[model samples]
Target: MKKIAQFFLKPTVPVVTINGQITEKSVIELEKNLKDIRVSTAKALAVVVNSPGGSPTQSKKMVDLIHNFAHDNHLTVYTFAEDLAASAGFQVLISGDKVFADQQSTLGSIGSITNFMNVKELILNQGIEIRSVTTNPASVTNQSMFKDVPEELRHVYENMLQSQHKKFIDLVEEQRGSKIKVPKEKRGSLLYNGDVFNGKQALEYGLIDSIGRVQDVMKEEFPKADVVFPQKPSISGKFMEYAKLYNLFQTIYQK
Candidate 1:
């Protein structure tokens, strides 16, 4: 009787994996997969994320894409943070209607960062000098890696980072809302100060809805639905994977 019921239901849930850095190429591929899912008979979408986070702009696009798809199709978005989901990755994680993570998964690190290096001394030691002329030398002078950032220019950078940081905080507050345990006034000093939490702690802080593997949680959330994951790699892809492993082993033995 149960088997007959399952056969008649025919529920399917399409899964999308967002791995590694969130770059232009990865975002484009994600959009393509979502487009395919948009037309499918599936009623829900599962996103598996394992990323240390990269490219804030790309991450924004990814979050927007998933949110738009969920809204348009009226499908539930289930996100699972595997291994690591920090910074921009966490931004994407919150896009899900329900989020899950492994007990040891690393999450959070909500903040903005910009790095600059002044190589003037290093080049000077090598007795090499680089010179260029531009229409607005004063405006571009402190912005160059060869020159130290002036106090005024530093303020500009700080303002930019603050703007970005505020955006991240707003998104979190909008999604998690009362789920966040941190007090309102102290949320800035506590939650949004670029700190990472393990899955257990993340659950306590209400960053994730639950702590479970994607497969297990999907079964519990949508029991009758058949979870359809992405296709396996082609023959050439498998060969490349093996070749990469072989190279790693050779390097390790040599070392």
Candidate 2:
């Protein structure tokens, strides 16, 4: 019976969901599940995304993995922007062999951001002994969030962000290839100045193939293949928030 079931059953097209803000832990779970599909009975993969985006570095890492999987394994990869695929979400979306967006989906925001709080006065008033210790001057300049950040440190950080943004543009251009048609407003700014667009605008800018649904996308790629979604790995969402807050406090208060 098992053999008959196996023999008669059709191949499945797995759908991987990328919802919420992307994070390192989330990407780890995504990669592990993707690898399972890569080795399982799935023939094609459809990625359904509804995200406002997150860390650029993490998004780029995911893009490389997805693109490599499709390229090296000779498989079809489709990415569907459900509602929102902004910033880092769009970065990952372009890696697919075919990318689509829902009619009302939002896209774009090609930029990077960093937040730092200068607590020098707060510590001085509290008489806190915040010892700034580091072996390397460069590391101190870049990582040490003590007092006000120096102009040199700001320059270095800005340069780092600019480099990442350029890489993003290059990747999008390579993937879309003469399809990008961003309006004048979205252009002529540092990192495209994090501009956003609706699905129609995104498609005009060659950011997506068409406005479509995940089910339709799967049917286009796999015809009558059954849908197979990998079991989502357990990730403690609330715990991660607490851990992140704790880490931020440590960075701010630790001597």
Candidate 3:
């Protein structure tokens, strides 16, 4: 009788959190949780994102995976922004079946960026002499801390940045169905400048559907249904774990 009753009941939405940098490890963890939910219950999945964005490749991969999972399982995927979801975070939001941003939550800055450091002055200031032997001339010639950056590396990075920027534009165009004219100058490497916009402005910019809360979405989409948050680690704990991993990796590589 109990087993028969289970057949008629739908499972609860599986909730996953994205609080920090979306790296390979983070994506894997999310995929695992989604898989568990798929196995345990035949229900929809909800992902809560509060991120400043990170690792474009990782973001794209995660979004692709989530989209595929929803298609395969015939499940609806919803995303709710708690505080902020910028840059690559926007990609994940677009992948959702329905996306909701908190009324005061921030979103947008749909772009990409890479950081580079110039350390020549610091080394010279310390009176440190460096010598290198490399099989390739370009390898040694391309590496510099004080001198002008090699044009080749600059072009390579620029090209990569432009490609990512185009990808972001494409995603937004596909999801929002609005034509946003991004000026040539604004489409450069500084596209992902970690900017935040309120929900009202986000809607104006066509970055999100409407200005509303997560509960509002649940009420509209799953009325008369129970909303559930799966058992999972808190966002703070996840961030701490990531910090530890980053520190360990830094220590090993620095040594």
For residues 44-158, write the lDDT of model 1, one tens digit per residue. 8899999999988999999999889888877889999999999889989988998899999999999988899899899889998878666654463437887677777787788
TM-score of 3: 0.74
Worst 10 residues of 2 by lDDT: 1-10
Badly placed stretches (over 4 Å) of model 3 are: 1-11, 38-43, 133-148, 178-196, 232-255
Ranking by lDDT: 1, 2, 3
In order, what lDDT does every prediction score? 0.83, 0.74, 0.69
Residue-level lDDT tens digits of model 2 in 179-238: 666654555462266888888887776778888888876777678787668664346854
- How many steric overlaps does candidate 2 have? 0
Return model 2's CA RMSD, one decimal: 15.0
- TM-score, candidate number 1: 0.82
Per-residue lDDT value at 58 in model 3: 88
Which candidate has the top score in lDDT?
1
TM values, all candidates: 0.82, 0.74, 0.74
Runs in model 1 deviating more than 4 A are: 1-9, 135-142, 231-255
